[model samples]
Structure formats: C-alpha cells, structure tokens
Target: MSVESKKTREACCSKLKLFLASMALVFFAKAFGGAYMKSSITQIERRFDIPSSLIGVIDGSFEMGNLLVIAFVSYFGAKLHRPRLIAIGCVIMATGSYLIALPHFLQGPYKYETSVSHSISVNSSESALPCHSNHSLSEDETPDVETRTACEKAAGSSLWIYVFLGNMLRGIGETPIMPLGVSYLDDFSREENTPFYLACIHTVGILGPMFGFMLGSYLAKIYVDIGSVDLDGVTINYKDSRWVGAWWLGFIVTGTIIMLSSIPFWFLPKSLPKQGEEESQSKSTELATVAEQGNFLPEENQDHEEKEKPVTFQELAKDFVPSLRRLFKNTIFTLMILTYLVSVNGFIGMITFKPKFLEQVYGQSASKAIFLIGILNLPAVALGIITGGFVLKRFKLGVIGAARVAFAASVGSLCLLSIQVFISCDNAEVAGLTVSYQGDTQVSYNQQTLLSQCNMGCSCSMKHWDPVCAYNGMTYASPCLAGCQTSTGTGREMVFHNCTCVGEMKSPAMNMSAVLGQCPRKTDCDRIFKIYMALSVTGSFISACGGTPGYIVMLRSIQPDLKALALGMQTLIVRTLGGIPPPIYFGALIDRTCLKWGTKQCGGRGACRLYDANAFRMTFMGLITGLYLLSNMLWGNLYLKIVKRQKKLALRNQAKENGLEGESRANGHASINIDTNKDDTDKESTI
Candidate 1:
C-alpha cells in the first residue's frame, strides 16, 4: 500500500473511534440524567407534597418536550450538521438539568409537617395541659391570612413547575441523540460491525442508569434540609415515607458531565467517509472484472447513485410525503411500532414506580430499593443487551430469527412479572386504616373509619397524617387517634402516654403509649423482599436480552435512506403516546391504594403516607403483564408475515434469474459474429 493511502486509512480509523467514543459518552450522560429523574420521583413527590397522579404528570413532562421538536429534528437534522446539532442538544440538556435543581436553591429549607412542633414554648404549653375531655382542638378553626401566606411560602407554591419545565427541556435535548446517532453510526460503519458498536453504546448507556440510581440511593440517605436544618431536631428516619433526599444534587453533577460531553462533538466533522472506502476504491479494477463475470450488485450500484446525488431542501420537502407513505406500507414495520409502543408504555410505568413499589410492598426503604435496582437490575440488563448482540452475531440471525428471540424474551419477562403478585408481603397494620385498632383483620377504607369510639371525644383531625406507632405494633393516624393524653421526651424520642387504643391489644399489662413514625414490619417481610429482588433481577435480565435483536429487526426491515426518519417517527410516536400517559394513569391507580394521606401546610391534601401493599402490587404488576402479553401476540403475527414474505421474494428472484439466462443463450452466436465484424471495421477506420 502507498504511504498516502495508509495515512488516509489510519485517519479514517481514528475518526471512527472518536465518533464511537463521543456517542457512548453522550449516551451514558443522558441515560444517567433520565434514570436519576426516575430514581428521585419519590423524593420529588414528597418534597413538593404532591400526590402520585400529579407526580405522574411531572414525570411525563419530558415526553411532552420530546413531542415538541423530535419530528422536525429527525427530518431536517439528517440534512444538517448532525454533530453540531447533538452538541447543542447536550447544552440544552445541561441547562435543563441545572433548571431542575434551581427549585432546591430558590425554595426555603425543607420543613416536613409534624404533629410535634419545634417551638420550646409550644412544647412546654402542650405538656402543661392535663388530660381533659375538651382539650381536643376543633378541626374547623381556619388559619389566619398571615399564617396561610406563610404556609404557602413555606410549601414553595408551584415550585414543582420548574422541575416539569426543566424535565421537558431535557426531553427536547435528548430527542436528537438516539435517532441521529444510530443512523450516523450505521451509515459510517460496516454492516457486520454495526451491531457490536450499538451493543457497546447501549452497554455504556446502561451504566448511566446504574450510576444515576446509585447516586440517587446515596443522596436519598442524606437529609434534604441537611445544611439548613438541625439533623438532631429531625424526627423521621430514611425509612419514613415523608423523608426527602438531596435529589437536586445529582442533577448538578449529571448536568456538568453532559455539558462536557458536548465539547468534542462541536470539533468533529459533519460526516466521515464510509468504513473501508479506501480499500474498496483500491480494489475497483478487480471488482469490475468480477462484475463482468456475472456478479450482480444492484444494491451497491443504488448506494453509489444515492451518494452521487446531492439532496436539496426542495427535494427533501417533496420526498417527505412519498417516504412516509412508503414506510407505513410495510406491515412488519407498522406492527413493530405498535408492539414497541405497548412495551414502552409498560416499561415507562414500571420504571417510574418500581422504587415506590418496592418500598411499599416489601417494607424496604426508598434508598435501598433504588440501590438494589441500580446495582442488581441495571447490570443484569446490561449483560442481557451484550449477550443478545452476541447471539445475533454468532447465529447471523435474520429479521425473522431476531423477532423470535425478542418474542421469547418478552414471554419470559411476562411470566416472571406475573409471579410478583404472589411474592408481596402483607398490607401494613395501620390503626383505623388498613385494620381495626382491636387487631381485627376486617379493613375499612372510608373517612368515617378514621373516627372510632376510642378517640371520638379527642376530636382528632381527619386531615392530619402524623402517624404514631402503638405498643400493639399497629400504627395510628396520629397520637390523638390513639387517645394519648400526654407525651415524654422530645423530637423522635418523644413518646405519647395513656393511650386508650392500647386497650384493644390482648396483652395482660395493657400499657398505653405510642411513638412517632410508622411501625416496622415483621422479620419475615425481609425474607420476602430478598426473594422478590432475586426474581426482579432475573426478569430484568431476560427482558433486556431482546433489546438488541428487536432493534435490529426494525433497522433491517426499513430502507437505508429512511432509517433516521423511521427511528425518529418511532420515537415520536412511542414517546408521545406511550411515554406521556403511562405515568399519569399508573399514578392515578396507585393513588387509589394510598391508605393514609398527608395534609399540606396550606390546608390541602399532600403526599400519601402509606399504601395498601397488596393493592399496589396487583395494580402495578397486572398492568405490566397485560401489556407484555399483548406485545407477544403482535410479535407472533409479525413473525409469520416476515417468513411468508421472505419465501415469496426468494421465488421471484429465482424466476427472474432463469429468464435472463434463457435470453442470453438465445442471442449468444449472433452477438459474437456482430462483435467480430464491428472490431474489423473499427481497425480499418483506425488505419
């Protein structure tokens, strides 16, 4: 090889490596941000005093942002400088990340609502008051204007909007990465090498969520009001539902990393030469000789023609309608989109709520749940994606084979998810909520149920959710509900005494007292949680095994020219329809399962204090299982169609070859004589 040729080849190789690294970096950064948001959903909810349904709306804002710009970017962006556009997107994502954390700074220090106030005077006065029938304060007394205003200011009125808008901006920023990056890589890399590159990108991308959730887990253990409030004065532990973490800190860290990732893209060229283009050009003469010996290469010729033709803006505009029409005409592509839509809907819902689910159902702390998902589930998914790519490459699976692999993985995941219904621990024993104070199993779920004979004279406000654990191991809505007349100690150590609710317990001593926070579950619950996590990790791995193969099936089925547009449309449709609605509805359903609801300082209902675990499990898992089953049926139909179409194409190509051979044989002798005469005439003319 010539020195110049070797130099060019080396330069091309270096550019390809740089591009791959850049793509992976951006992928990792974005994945980290998105996963961090998912992991912090519970914290965000508590911090803002919002219900699950409202939190869903907040979570879905990212998709709303994607819906605004994805179609235009995907279509017009292919004709523009893709690298620069991606860089700009990264900047926007960073800005959005910073914006999400802005509320944490703008708002006052986190102050959780508690029955026990921090004021020393108020504590002394409350302790001095003896047990009396008329001691209970009336719930009807409205707060004065000054107090209401202060409460609203303390609650950070509508500050969550910043988070929603910021998340939406993040969504818009992420719109360009996947469709453009994948198409760019596919265009520049060799066909056989594409899967490996994608697998690597995704494997790195999976690490983002792992790290993001890990960060979330760590931050969740720290108090949200860490520097602003006295940790000693705080009564709640990390396990309490009211605990809010330093959720904003991760956003700052992730945002900075994402901004750094954008720098290299700005310096990179708009496009690079196809992999091995130099080698192909060097072998042109030999390739032409092979072609003359009856080697057919229409696909290669078409590719060459496409590269030769420059795309104009007008031409792109004119071609849009025709291209869209052609894409939807393919039954397999449409079915793939539908199946993916359903699967994504389930996935979005599951990921958004899985941490909350684990915390409620299995009696695990929020931080621990997030940590387990990050450490165990995400790594398993990464392994599955890599293994799936290996399976495709090793077996050289075609479109139909890839579909089968995806379908099987979905079935396996669905089966495992179904088992979760039976794996849950029992509902928490909350007094006047999930169970009667008398330890009766009969549970009532009405507002009136909160007012029982034991504490009716105490005039306990139904609005407050200051839960206190009783000696009977049952938790009351508040100390007042337990008919506790006096308290001892201070902060979390303070204990209510002379509780009438303790009479319901069959113990001989009949000691009457209740402390702050919800009661912990039995030791058996921990064993159940371990079992659930093991099954969850296994299911995650199996489900992720289909990721690469399913993506390949879509990529292979689509035309090369429409690849970016198809991917963008798939994202647009899936994100707009699938991503935006699942959280809202799933949260709405989960809201119904909330046994105890917290009261906001501004005289409105706040976040849920406790959930009916059995109901939450059934609702969450049932929806996921149903969606997966539907996706599987669609895959089965799609597989049969692909097989039938392949057979037809094979038959048609064979018939065309036979016809061409017959025509050549018929003209063989006459063509040779004519060629000889023409050669003799040409020689005479030259002389």
Candidate 2:
C-alpha cells in the first residue's frame, strides 16, 4: 500500500511467471552447451590425436571445476540475491565455452596420417609394379620440414589443456545454477505447484541437448577448416577415423546463447511474493496472468517495508558444517545421494562414449551416429522426465509413493539394458587389426607386427591408417599395406589395383581392385543395429521416467532450511565422485580395446584408428550394467528407510494423541471427585 512497495511492484516484470520463463531459458542454454560438448567429444579426440581415456579426463574437468566452489556458493548464495548470482555464473560459463574453442585456433590444420599421394594418384590403365623398390610413402611429402616442425610444436604444446581449463571454468560457472536457481524457484512458489514448475523447466531444458546434438551433427558434416583448406585434396570422408569436424564452432554459438541468457537474471528481483498470494496493487495483472494460465495471485508481504539483509560470510561458515551434518544424518537422504552418485557415474560414461560405440561396433558414420542420438535418445529422456513430474502431481505422491515409482522405473530400465548387452554387432573385418590379410579373424592386438607376409614385400608403414576396401569385401589398413601397385582417380574416388594382399598372392588371374575407406558392415549387422537403437531409446525413456520423482524424494526428505545446502552438496558430492571419475575410467577401459592405434605426425601413439568391437561393447555396456545394479540396490535400501521413518513418525503421532486424551479424562474425573467431597462437607456442616 506504501509508495515504496508500489514502485517495486511496478518494476514491469517482478512476477514469478517471468522468473520461471527466464529459468527455463537459462536451463535450455546450459543443457545445450553441455550436450553439444558431449556430441563433439569424438571430433575433439580425433582433432588433437588424443586417446579416449585422456578425452575422459578433459570431460571430467568440468566436474573438477564444480568441486572447487559449489558448496560455498550454494549455501552462501541462498541468503543473498540468487537471481543475480546465477547471472554471474552464466557469464563465467560463457567465458569457459569461449575458452574451450581457444585451442582450435592456436593449432594448425588437421593432417591425418595417410599414405595416399594426391600428385600421382590419378587413374592409370597400366598397373605399377607392386614390388617396386620405391615402396609406398616415398611419393607423397606428408609434411615439409617447416610444417613438420610446426606439428611437433603443436603436439608437444598439449593444446588440449586449454579445453580442460575451459571445461573446468564451465563447470565452475554451472555450479550455482541448478542449486541456486531451482531453490530460488522452489522458495517463492507454492508447494503444490513445485513439481509441475520443475517438470516444465526440465522439459524445456531437455530441448537444449536435443538442439545441441543436432547442431553437432550438422557441424560434423562440414570440414574443420572449411574456409581455409582445399577439400579437393582431402581423401577421407566423415566416416573415416581421421576425420575431424568443426567442433569449435558450436562452442562459440552456445557461449553466446548462455551470455545472452544471463541478461534477464540481472533485471530480475532477488525475491518475489510467493506464487499463491493476492496483492491489491497487482490484482488486475495477476488475474490476467491466471487465465494466461490459471494465473498469478501474488501474496501481500507484510515485510515488503523491510528489506531483507544479505547473508554474510561469517553466518554461512557458522551454519554450513552443522547443517551438512544434520542432512547426512537423515538415513533416507544419505542413501538417496549415494544411489544418485552410482547411477550418474554410469550415465556420464554412457553418454560420453555412446556415439563412438555406434561408430565402432555398428559401423555407423560419426555424423549419423550423432544425429540419431539427438533425434531419438534425448527426446525420449525429456518425455520420461516430464511424465514423472506429471505422475507425481497427478497422484499427489508422498515420499514413499515417489520412491516406489523411482524404484520401479529403475528396475524396468535395468531389464531393458540387460537385453542390449547381447544385441551387439560384430566388429568390422579389417586386415592387420581385427583380422589377418588372408581373411582370418584369429588376431591379437600385439600381432600387428606380423599381420601378413603379403604387405611385407610392399614396405608399408603400420602407422598410416588409410583404409581401402577391396572388391572381395576385405578392409586393408592402407593402400600400401594392401599391396596396391597403383591408384586411380582422386580423393574419395581414388582406387588401387593389383593389391597382392587383397589377392593373397594366390590367384594372379583374379582382379584385386580396392577403393578408399573401410568396407561397410554386413546386412545382418545393420538389422541388429536397428534393434539395438530401439532398445537403447526404450531403456533411456524408462529410466528417465523416474527422474523427477527421485528428485522429489530427495527434496522432501531433507529439512526445509537445508534445501539449498542439500542441493549444493548433491552437486558437489555427485559430481566429484560420479561425474569426474566415470569418464576417465571408462575411457581407460575403452582404450584397452584398441586393436590399431594411429600415430602422431611428430611420433607418439595417437587416437585409436580401430577397436576390437566385442571388447568395446563388453567394457562399455558391462560398466553401465554394474553401476546401475549397484544403484538399484541402494534405491531399494532408500525406499525401505523412507518407509521405516514414515511408520515411526505415524506411531509417534498416534501415541501423543492417546496420551493427551487420557490426561484430559483424568482431569475431568478429579474435578467430579472434588465436587463430591465439597458437597459431603456441606451436608455434614448443615446436620
């Protein structure tokens, strides 16, 4: 009713609806940045000649950044202006995204190791002698003395460290958003409306990864140096292991989006009157908003005249450790955190390498693999989250009910996941890798030196991985390794003839011609790949359906005052243990399955050119299965704890009610007896 209150209310957009909309946009931008990074991970590995394990470390760097400041930020920022802190976090995140792209500019153009010669690889009617003493790589100059020196400098510089630092910055920037942002939304919103609000925000946030992956897929089709380099001379397609797409471009776009999303938060007020209240000044505006969706009724705040003081450092430090101890003391809460940690460990690893697995095991192209995930898997997850939120709101589920739903989803999804472990496709039949040059699958990774006597006469380099598919349906490591006497055409059109290795040096009459790129997988494998995707999407949806309910269980289990701290702790603990390590360990295990590794131009071992497909499948899927099973066990324990606590509370309340009734009855009886005694005394006096 006062002028000051009126002015604050008239600030054009101090409504919870506006806040929700802003949060949704921020969520979308953040998820987009994150998912885009995941999608581009493969390209990054190829570009830097980095192995999968090291890439895992780089991915974990984001979590590392969170470990630095999440706890302090969440607890302290709660009493301060949450919206403004979130704005600052977004800016830091944008800076990190920009930093991730820094290494790309600092390095030279990507030059994959290849033995094909652009100058002399034209079509030739007469086949050159396969046994010529000049051999394979002597024709083309891979890098001149100067370029070679630059490559050495690039390789030695560890440019990937920039990505690590940038990703870490992103992690730090992201630390506050979920804990502070979600808690802020929850604080001012009605309790009943909380689940729907969360669902809507998460549903919108899910769009970010969908778009991010789509962007990555689109960018994967274009060359990394599209404008700078001549594509005519490039021999590999996007399907080639050597291919590096424009991974840096998406970061630039995502960074800008995140920066722009920060703008609205600065304009937003720190606190709003809770969602259900009715304010006279904004009565008309609130009514219109309600049908603009059963709109706003802002509660009049008696404390509007009093500005809330900002939380100080001393107050936070004093309360933090004590509050944390109180939270973990809750059996259900601790169990829930542990359960989430285990599940997320599996998720981070699965999401990070799923694209690479598709490329390796099922023979999907990088671009196609990425595109399928964006189009299929992510949307299913978003739907599942939305469904879970809807289910909670519809049923008005309590802690026990919510836990049951989450547990059921976990079990159902686990069953589906078990099916995928057996649905894998056979490994690509590549000579000197998964098989011998003479069409035998009896090969070990260590047997690369003695792969075939057929290519030995050609003096081929095992380091070069320019694959050529022979007409007989066998993949030779390279033209030189395939004993191709001559080449035809250029770029993707180039071919080699008189490939003695493809012929096995047996039948001179047979035509042993080969073309660029590895052979496509058999039709049977393609059919099985489709089956795998269906199961993958189904499992993702089923598992994700539990997301909102599980989150609700955690939210309801803790004390109201510790909500922000609890959320922050969850991020800190889960990210540190679950997020940071899974990628590293999974990548290390995946690296062990490499049957053929590429070589850096300056000479160290490079990113894997080929993997033992069965090993990759077992390692990736097996890790996820084990983690999920552990989480299921924990989830079951959490449910039992919740039920036990609820029962104890019910019994305690009943006992207190009974005791109060008995005391009242006893008091009534004593009053009657006193009246009787007084009456008898009166009678005696009268007599």
Candidate 3:
C-alpha cells in the first residue's frame, strides 16, 4: 500500500479509538444517569410521597433541555476546537451532576413550610372531624381532637421541585457533550471511516447507561439500607439522615466527582478534529464578504463602517426569504422532511409504548415490561447506524428508501404485535390461575388440570378435590360432591357429606406462572427478560438486515450528499407524526371497552386493577397484536414506495444524462462536415 494510504488508515484507526473513548464516556454518564434516575424516583417518592405523573413530567423536562440545546451544540460546539468543546461540555455536565447531587437544604422559607403544614392539618381536621358549636356537644364530650396529620405537603412538594431542578441543571451540562463528542469524531475521520467511528461512539456510549445503572443500583442499595433503619428506635440517630447525609444525594456527589475528573481529559489533543487549511478557507469563503467602499469621509467614519453593526433582523429576513422560497419549492426536500418527521415520531412512540403494551399483555410490572423495549431499541439503533453507513458506500440511497424500510418494519412489527394482542384479548382463556368452587372445595383449573379432570370422570367431584386436597397432606372433612348419587330404599339418595363448606383460597395473579409453573428457578423478571431478549434480537436483525438493504436501494437511486439529510428528515417526520395514534386510538378503545368481571372491587374502576391477571393479559395481548400488525402494514407500504422511487429516479437520471451526450455528439459531427466542405471549396477556387 502507498504511504499515503497507510497514513490514512492509521488516522482512521485513531479517530475510531477516540470516538469509541468518547462514546464510552457518554455511555458511562448515561448509565449513571439511568440508575440515578431510577434511584432518584424511588428516593424522592419515599421522602416526599410525590405522584409518579409529576416525576415523569420532571424526567421529561430534562430530555427537553437536551432537545433544545442539541442544535446549538452542533453549530457552536462544532465551530470550536473539538477537544475544547468536549472539555467545556464535560465541565458543564460535571457541574450539573454536582447540582443534582446537592440536596436542597433551604426548602422554601421556614414560614412557608410551616404555613403549608398548617393548612394541610387544617384541611385534615375539616374533613375528618366536623366543626360543632360549643353548645351542640355535651360538657364532657370528647375534647376537640388534636390529631397529628401525616401530610407534610410542603416537604413533599419541595423535595420533588428540588429534584426537578437538579435534573434540569444536569441536563444543561449533558446536552452539549453528546453532539460535541460525536461530531468531533465525524470531523476527525475520513468519509469512509465516519460511520465506523460513529458506531464505535454509539456502542461505547451505550456502556454509559449500563455503568450508570450498575453504579446507581449499588449506591441505591445504600439508600435502601438507610431507609430500612427503624426510626422507632431511640438509640439510632435519625437526624444524620438529613439533606447532606441522604445516601441518594451523597451518591450523586460521588458521581459528580467522577464526571468532573473526565472533564480535563476532553482537552486532550487526540480529541480534536483535523480540519485542513483548504477546508477552513472553503468554509470561510462561503460567508458573505463585506467591503467598505472607499469612504471619502474621515478615518473615524471608515472605522465605523469597518466594524459594521451585526446584520439587522430585517436584512436577515430579506436574505432568508429567497432561500426559504427556493427550499420550499424543492419537492424532494419537502418530501424528505415529511418522511423524517413521520418515521421518527412513529418509531419513537412505538418504542416508548412497547413496554407498556408488553406490561399490559404479559401481566408484567413496568420495569419488567421494558426488557423487551430495551432489547429491541439498542439493536434497532445499531442497525440503523450500521445499515445507513454501509449501504451508501458506492451508491446513494435517499431518505425515501430508508424511511420506507424503517417505517415498514416498524409498522409490520407493530401490526404483528397488535394482532397478537387482539387475539389474546378475544380469546376465552384467562392468563392467571383459573379457580372454581365445585359444591364446596375450591378447585384449581388450568388447561392441563381441566383436561385431566375431564378425562378422569365426567361428573366426578373427587377429581376436582385431588389437586388442593394434598395442599398440606391433611384431608378435609368436607369435600366437593360431584353429580353422583347412591341408591336408597325408596329412590336415589344424593350424598351430601364433605360438600357444604367452601373455603376461599388465594391465587397469584400472574398468568405466565399460573399457566406455566414457576419458570424453573427464573424469577418473573427472568422469564420476561427472555421474551424481551427475543424481541430485542428480532428488532436488531430487522434493523440491520432491513435497514441496510433498503438504504442501498435508496442510495443507488439518489445523490450521495442528500442521503444523510434525507434520513434526518425521515426520522424527524415519522417521530413527530407517529406519536398521536396510541393515546388517541388505543386509549379510546380502552376507555370504551371496560373488561371487568363485575366484582365490586374490580368493577369500581371501569378498567380492572393493574394486578388483575385476566384483565392485564387481555389488555396487553390486544394492544401488542394491534400495534404490531399496523406497524407491519405501514412498513410494507413505505418500503415498496421507496423501492419504486429508487428505481425510477436512477433510470430517469441515467436516460436524461445519456440523451444529452448523444445530442452533443451529433452536433459536433455536423460542424465537422461543414468545415470539411469549406476546405474543399477553397482548394477548388485555388485550382
């Protein structure tokens, strides 16, 4: 290989290393964040008893900060030396971590706290104890009750507000780092290696959440220990568990330290992007040139013009209008944006809701439900990046194809899941333990037990009693009597022995376990995790295989430079537009169709309780199947369109360009003939 080629390879390798390192930092930070977030919620909830909805809003607010600041990070951060930008971001992120780590000592003013506390006490008294005139009650009546109400409303509210502030501040620190780090590598790497660098960064970045969760979980255990302490014991010093001493806050402080230490490393020379002078000059040339016309005026006037005031809004608007018009007129760009928004919105919403849908279907907890989501998402992301990078190496795939394939897959999976859900919902079988009382004894019924009992005897109550009868190896005096009778003197005499007493038995409301016994040493989480793993693997495969192939088709049809832009547009459009369906459509269905068994406890709320096995199973199955199926259909249509567009564009562009070349050739031939005739005429005149 040429020395130049060798150098290029070396440089690419270095960029990849740096990119991976940065990504690792990002991943660790996120890992910390994830774990911290989970622990924070638990801590804040316990400390202040805040509602989960408020927490969600607060959590989402942090994400908003990231969204709003990302463009700034890309624009301004990109302008700065890559290392410097990264360092600055690191510093800011560390500061935010510190802010989050610090507990809010001054919770409103003391008087405000007291007033809120007083108001809550008063409210409690007003609700629980009626106000009566002195004369209304007897002289020896119970003294005006002075009950200690537990509602420390101000403390609770203040605690969450503080957490929100911490998170928000932390977000400010974090937002710039991502684009800074990623773009740094992009700038540093050659075109071919850019994607690999990006992937390295991404993969390494994933480690952040993993690390964060591990760290957070470990530290969270400390918090849990503190919480487990009995405040009832006078021997223990409860005062130490104050704002500064709180394990949650303390852990944040430790995390902040680690985050801060990484800041200086961002200044390392290795992190900087290598922009040649030519590239710099080219970029500078693109900016509008300002020339001061030979001012016949004094030096002062010339100086004033030299330091011309920043462009006015009006002037900027005038310049912008033409560009806007030009861009708006482009059908391709417009379509690209629309496609982006649709794809992004749809995919994001789908991922976000997948866990909830799973939780609903499989009768799993929120955390457990997310296993599938996590598995699916990482692969999806990986595939998207990998496919996008690899597909357009030679040919160019526009946004259309990427959008089509991504959406189609998303739609297909969603539809399949949705169908599964619908079938589950419509099916007759309950997910959890199906128990029925026959005469007296409660009998456990499942597909297996039911079949066994049915096969043993058509109307044998003894078969019903066999399962629970051996609960403790003690036989009950009264067992359920089947439709069996003994012959008596006058007629058939029905036996009523051991058949009058019905005892209530408790059953776990887990369908997976009930249907298929304890997952052989695997916790509910483990079993759910397996399913999540499968889903994730499937999603990853779909993304890698489907996304890459689709992009190849797209690039072959479109120009290379436009591919990235097109992809971005597709993501933006899909994400924005796709978010509406679940809340509007699925939510409506859930509201309209109440799936309750009519028991007072279950029926009070139109929808069954979260723990209700039958209710959960029905809901989840319905949701997953419906959504997956819809996704599948949508994806298929989008992919097909993309494929067609790719083929057409390629053919059209080739034909047009080829036709122009042929015309030029013919024109040249005609000109040559005329020149030859002129030469001949000149020779004849000379003779």
Local distance difference test scores for all models: 0.81, 0.80, 0.37
Please give, for residues 309-377, the per-residue lDDT of candidate 3 as tens digits: 455556644644443343333333444344434443434334433433444445333333333334445
lDDT of 1: 0.81
Q: How many clashing pairs does model 1 include?
A: 0
Model 2 stretches with alpha carbons more than 4 Å out:
1-14, 118-131, 136-151, 154-157, 279-311, 447-450, 505-510, 659-687
Candidate number with the higher TM-score (1 or 3):
1
> Runs in model 3 with CA error above 4 Å?
1-20, 31-52, 70-87, 97-150, 170-174, 177-188, 212-228, 231-412, 419-533, 540-687
Could you tell me every candidate's TM-score relative to the true structure? 0.90, 0.87, 0.53
Which parts of model 1 have CA positions greater than 4 angstroms off? 118-132, 136-154, 279-310, 508-511, 660-687
Deviation (Å) of 327 in candidate 2? 1.9
lDDT of 2: 0.80
Window of ten residues with lowest summed lDDT in model 1: 289-298
Model 3 / residue 2 / CA error / Å? 12
* Steric overlap count per candidate: 0, 8, 68
The TM-score, computed over Cα atoms with residue i paired to residue i, of candidate 2 is 0.87
Mind giving the per-residue lDDT tens digits that candidate 1 earns over 46-140?
Answer: 99999999999999999999999998788878777788899999999999999999999988887776655633224432462223477546544
